[model samples]
Target: MESFLVLAVLTSAARAQEVEWRHDYTFARREALDKNRPLIIDFTTENCFWCNKLETTTFRDSAVLSLLNDKFIPLKVSAQLNPQLTEALRIQSFPTLVLAAPDGKILSTLEGYLEAPKLAGHLQRTLTAVTNPDWMVRDVEEANKAITAGDQARAMGLLKSVLEDNQERPIQVQARHLLKDLEKQAADRLAQARQLEDKGQNAQALQALTKLLKTFPGTQAATEGGQLLTTLALKPEVKQEQRTRRAQELLTQARADYQNQQFLCCMDHCEVLAANYGDLPEGAEAAKLVEEIKSNPEWMRKACESLSERLALLYLCLAENLLKKGQPHEAALYLERVIQAFPSTPQAEVAQVRLSQIQGQPTQQTDFKKAAEKEEGPAVP
Candidate 1:
């Protein structure tokens, strides 16, 4: 009789529950990526009553089990154990459900207890949202259009977006092929620029590299070209020659604007020339032009009114660099200028945070980036 009861209990236990949940988040995340499916992450605490209730009840439902095992990768994580993941996801409550795309983008987050039907409904809706039967065809078609328009940057961006969104075999094959072709063209241009540089035709090489950078801003070739461009710009001979030529170009623009009585535009060119090539003869020329403008009270007033708005970005950039170099005092002076003079600009908003960091902290060792790091949200139970 005892043996018969044991056998019956074993049979009942075998038929009891069905959800195939992977406990390790890392393994499940890789599985989701490989399978090109979304993930359902269940966050729980060790002693949470609702989490236990969820494990025993809703997870046992056939519909939920089928959906999880069939359409989505289900991962169970302990909130107390995976603090990093919890903080990154910004979780703030127990029994939270995070539905994420294969690329790790959160599709939906649910906090508190969710019944079997509601959870299943949420999962089904998220699945429907991510299910795109035409993303492959649509993106490739748009990319081809961009390529035809001679916009290689747009084409590369579109192709990259496709590769990131979907990992299906067919889409992956086509997107990579197109991306490789675009990179090939960028590479050819980059090679031509290098040839010019090798021949000591520094000016022509700079022009070619600038064009390549503009045409393929995100490609590997453009990245190499950027390094080469910096190298060429750093050479004493190249630097001197380029600065002279560029300053002359700015002076020419300033002169043309002066002749047209566009004193504000003339001031803009003068400011750039004075800031960059201040020791060059063009700096004296720019100063002379500014002096000529100041003779006209109306022109000087118009320039003073317009120049601050344009210079706000430049000042903000300079302040950020100073902060990086542990010179917060200098950085703060510029930051204050942005806040006080160009308060309406987007740069002013950034400046306020950086300025506060300088005032709030005792040391000058902090950077704007560190000050800009947002505080974490409330803790998850």
Candidate 2:
């Protein structure tokens, strides 16, 4: 029984260390590039208890370890020993996990310790994104083809789908550009109604606006026309059209708020539209927009978070490069800036650790400030 128990312990230890982590980031990068796979950088420190917990617990989980071993070029980076590499990677905290494309563009980052299940999910998503690379070019080409075929509706639908699904900033900008062109085309189609309204042809303008709304339902021009109908309805002679116009105006405003990234404001407008104009065409669009916003509440937040991480990484990289050139003071200044500007972020934690190391202080002695106070407890074992 004693021999069996010792054998079991040895076997478990071997299983726990199953993930073949590359010690060198450069080698891992090279392997990832060659294989066209994502580079998974696991940033850790000698004194980080959480990092040990991650290795012993989450990383020991068979599913999590198997996925990392199979799908990713995993690199184990020591934050203490590899200061320059750590800074370059912008490892803000111990146990900061980064998933990057073969070209070293960071796809996603998870700070702090995650349980096996959550980490597995993140790994799966990253693997899917890396392996099944979805390019905006395909959607762009499809939209262009639809436009050439004179299928404006089909083209608009494709563009909208791009906006909804594509997270790449460049692709989003391109989609927006295409949408602007489509919006202009739509505006031209409704020019007659606007002209009639400008000429004080109230009945004719109303007729034209109604026709535009019917012909181009669920469009930007239709939305604008709906709002204008509300404005016209407010006139003493057009009071009879007031009821539906108010709802249309609310729905239009809700959509505008959503596009502007004012998510909370959009929700408020959507609620009003739903309560008052649920039966109207604009209301239907509003309902869809509300559902989309609710379903993907983190879309804008994730974008902002990704941008912040990139900016922090930029500063850290610059600082590291400067330090390598024998400019400790300048490096310290950049680290200080990171701590000051992005307190509570992973970058801030890294800065704190690095700064402490430079000052001959304890690595665990971090003067980190929280972005928001929360119930504090050990995040890992």
Candidate 3:
């Protein structure tokens, strides 16, 4: 009966586990590339902590799970069983997401524990950069020429637009940082002008600052443009009003929240902005947020939680996601976090029982895992 009980528990555990939808190598190669999605290869080992955390927490997240399902042919390679494959992929980390082409060409790679939004952003950016036909990677020499020849405006314009549009793309992050530094030089020139003006050298100050404003309109340097124009009694062509500035400020705030893992607040602000815009770019962004929220309300809530709200519900969803995965040990860890963090909530009570079962206590069995694993691939659902 003890052996039978063990068998029953194992069966139940298997049933509860939500196997990532996956495809065989052949099918993955054909279908994934055809759809312009990368073949997502996850290199993992048994009993690895972050690996299991990803499987239980991140992968099980409905938003992340849906993106994986919709955007890639996911492959889970057990590094132990496939040493050759691991070595070939150069697996130095336990949970590395390899973005590969259908022909076994690795486009790029991301490693470590990524929260849902960031993971999704990285995935989308890598895929966009890799799969697109017209990506231009200019050499540093060419880029320098563009800058030195007074084409800095053109180069900066292109790079800045790309960075803004692809904020989650790793390449964009690097590009943006580089551009920001360059912009700072222009801003410094403007500041020097202000110092000259303070010293009563008005003519020299105006000359020095005017050079920067003319070169980079709508930039940090350009903030002084309006003031300088007013001083000269000249009306410059470009004008960003108070309302426009306020809108831009709000967008910046929303982007910051999105970056800081406050996705729900990001979504909320997006929605409000969208309503005002009447189906403009912000509206489309808000639509995307609505879709993401619908896909993973539980995980998003946890991710977007504020300091004031109780975390019991978020913990419950985490526990549930873990229960869906086969990692009881890791599931129990999060369940404890939930219990300890939000002990008063009813969700915590349910989490306590789930945690007990995860810690080897007996629980009712189910066939959901087998059914789930039987799905075609990560994109199966």
Candidate 1 residue-wise lDDT, 315-369, digit = tens: 9899989989999899999999987776445677778777888899443333333
Instruction: Choose the strongest candidate by TM-score.
Output: 1
User: lDDT at 255 for candidate 2?
Assistant: 74
Candidate number achieving the greatest lDDT relative to the actual structure: 1
Model 1 spans with C-alpha error above 4 angstroms: 1-132, 165-168, 264-281, 287-381
Local error of candidate 3 at residue 193 (angstroms): 0.7
How far off is residue 32 in model 2, in Å? Answer: 4.1
Candidate 2 runs further than 4 Å off? 1-17, 23-36, 88-90, 101-107, 128-141, 148-152, 162-381
lDDT per residue for candidate 3 within 217-315, as digits (tens), equals 668777775587456433231222323444556677777876776876776677777777534555566566656665886746665455324466666
Q: What is the lDDT of candidate 3?
A: 0.66
Residue 251, candidate 3: C-alpha displacement in angstroms: 52
| Model 2 lDDT tens row, 39-96 | 8889998878999999889988889888888788889988887999888767788889
- Ordered by TM-score, highest first, the candidates read 1, 2, 3
Best of the two (1, 2) by lDDT: 1
Clashing pairs in 1: none
Evaluated at residue 165, the lDDT of candidate 2 is 55
